[model samples]
Target: MVSRQAGLLLAALVALAGVSVVGGEVVDAPPTLTVENDGDTTYRVTAYTVESVEDALLTNFRVTTPAGENRLVTYSQLVWPAGYRNVTVTDSVPSQQVTVPPNEAVETEIRVWEPGDVTIYIIEEPDDETHVWSDMKACTERQQEHSIRLRDGYEGGGSTCASDLDLLFR
Candidate 1:
């Protein structure tokens, strides 16, 4: 005959096993894409995946304005895990371009079900032509290194533009 303590221990072990089986594996949170504007001029930031993979998943595209407003850019859906989505600045007066005013910031967050890379473009539309101010590539392996802050007409993290300017000014 088993002791009462042994019976309770066995019941606890069985319960833990059941719970583990029911819960399965825990999923990781999707990666994030953040863009900060610290320059005097306004900009429109856009992000999109580079290449679409067959087994990859992309969903929950959200765009947050500088004024603390949250808006849904895309519905929760699966798409080829590669391609660029022009992130519209929701706070701008003109709807055609999402504008980030001076000293303001914007962010685009999406749920990435697969591992891939993305490209973010900082564009300026002064006239009919759209000029690309800066662009940075982001991947899962380098997600933390991807946050870009545009300050004094230069993007952070040792961008080539900064180097070029340094050489030109010297």
Candidate 2:
């Protein structure tokens, strides 16, 4: 009877959640993107940022790999025509990107270092204090209008959805 209910629903998903189905597909539920360097400085990514909270900082694209490769990029989200809308426009995602092998209930692993190029900003906001104002300023009289609206050009869907991912640290 339908292969005995698909073999009792794949043996109750391999005895409850230790799933590893074959042919029916579910080998460890893959959908990954794990990059770890653990020091020895090699990060040559130069791009990867997707953490927005209603204001901006969402889309920025450009990927023409093949001049020495390093590719790993994926983004799908963009549909926030807020307030009174009638949208059905397809093609423009970034509502909240970056979740490759990283979804601790929607990502949050802050790490920042400077000296040009090595960006991996993916913090699906909600840690409060209005999009995490640096140095943890709970409130300081509007902290200069929230640091001048967090340095003005907050960057949302810029390039209207470019695309990138060159996280190479080998």
Candidate 3:
């Protein structure tokens, strides 16, 4: 009877909504950050600005690439303390263009262009946003990172990224 009751409890928990799983710790889904390159090159770039604890842009820190490549991207460099909170986080990326391989998701890194306390959030490509963002704990942190490569003549792609709940409430 005890075993049966435990199974039932597990089923009840599974039925609940808004549960996510991340790094073995259950958390809500993260937001999606999307980007596109509409120029004539083999690489592309996207930029996002992380907000300060007051939900305003923190201008103290500057973002740049250590590598000399013109294709380097510094999407996330601003950092924040663990307990830091912000009700709103806004992102801005100026329009740019480039070319990429056809139907491939490339792997790359965005280091700290400027040193600061900011959380890095990269958008996921070719994923089910609805299912991923479902209220489940097993889906919090991303398991792997990948980005879609636009083929010649392809227009654009849509993606999203989720933020920690602490930031949402702040």
Candidate 4:
């Protein structure tokens, strides 16, 4: 009887693991990273994943250069909770600012100059005064990594870049 009970408990756990509901959408619950090529030959990336109740949302992103130094990137907005905004970029190569919405899914770009396999990170704190660190409930429970590229386009002797951002839902 003990063995049978253990089997039933394990089956229940497995069933729970397979169930996922985000924003009322039936999902498999995999962590995902999104990348976009914005106008002006810049790239924008936003990482979204599941989070524990204890985590906060004042997050940041980082891109590492071939030189081994990390360049902090900025965002124009946050998608969750609906109206948080960003004002400046710190430790970022091409400094920029953004306006974030609260608790919703968003992918706004702040800066991008080159193209390569980039490692994007979601930081736990805001970089400057204008931007508040992601709140504790805004944190992700599982960790994920992603790579993005920014391409340059030229038309009529002028340069025009566009963002073809990709959204991943897991």
Best by TM-score: 1
> Residues 1-170, candidate 3, lDDT per residue (tens digit)?
99999977755663453455356555433233233334343433332323332322332312222232222212222332111111112334222222233343444432221212223332211211110000101122322122333433224443333344433332
lDDT of 1 at 27: 28
Model 2 Cα lDDT, one tens digit per residue, 19-54:
355887543221122223232222211123222332
lDDT of 3 at 97: 22
Q: In model 2, how many backbone clashes occur?
A: 11
Greater lDDT among 1 and 2 belongs to: 1
lDDT of 1 by residue, 35-109 (tens): 577777766644444333221123234434334454544322212112223334332111122457688876554
List CA RMSD, all candidates.
15.5, 19.7, 14.1, 16.0
For 40-106, candidate 4 gives per-residue lDDT tens digits of 4322222332222212122244434334455554332332212233322343333222322222233
lDDT for 92 (candidate 1): 19
How high is the lDDT of residue 86 in model 3?
Answer: 19
